[model samples]
Target: MASFHFELVSPEKMLFSGDVESVVVPGADGDFQVFAGHAPVMSTLHVGVLKIAGNTNAPQRVFVRGGFADVNDSGLTILAEQAVDLAEVKSDQLMQDIRDLEEDVADAKTDAERARAQAKLEGLKALQLAVAH
Candidate 1:
């Protein structure tokens, strides 16, 4: 399979930089895959897992919380707001966060607060499902 240079960066640091066969991005509109020689494009990413198939290492999955993906002649670059290696995520911690957010949702005093809590709860659930898979 053909490979292209791919980079995943966040405010804290560059998480990934390598040649990859393909990448599955969690675009805001929907999921999309990019390969070498893919059409040039830009997309906003949602809170989801980004999958990378690389040349040497085992396939990797990283969780990204909002970002932008830019594909051009050089390769694909993802400027993520936050990135965390799926393997490094502690399930217990995630579960605790979900439980806390659930309580926040239930205890919210205003409509805006409830909405914010609900959205966070949904994102956390999605992350939990991703970890399960």
Candidate 2:
């Protein structure tokens, strides 16, 4: 099977780096898939799950806060502000975070602030779905 080098990196550390058959990323516009020999491109990413199909038996999942994906002849590079492996994510913590965001949204004084909180809540819901499976 054909594969491409996929690297997920954050400012604090390198999360995952390996060769994968394909990757599904949450592009700013929507979701997009990348395969081996994919055309070179760059895009802004949203807060959502990134799924990578490696050579192993199971696929890997990572939740990214926000970032940019740079795909080139070399490979795919994800520069994320925050990224967490789904396997390592704690459900309790995530639930707590969701609750906090909900409260913030309720108390939000301005439309912009409410929108931001809503976005955060939506991201957390996506993360929950990713972690569930």
lDDT of candidate 1 over 18-122, digit per residue (tens): 899999999999999999999999999988899888655633998888889999999999999878888888999999999999999999999999999998898
Q: Output the number of the lDDT-best candidate.
A: 1
Global Cα lDDT for candidate 1: 0.90
Worst 10 contiguous positions by lDDT, candidate 2: 54-63
Predicted candidate 2 versus true structure: per-residue lDDT over 1-133, tens digit per residue: 6988988899999877788899899889998999999999899998788888865633377888889999999889999977888878888999999999999999999999999999879878878877876
**Residue 18's C-alpha lDDT in candidate 1?**
85
Model 2 — TM-score against the truth?
0.74
Error of 1 at 26 (Å): 2.8
Highest TM-score against the true fold, candidate: 1
TM-score against truth, every candidate = 0.79, 0.74
Any runs in candidate 1 off by more than 4 Å, and if so which?
55-59
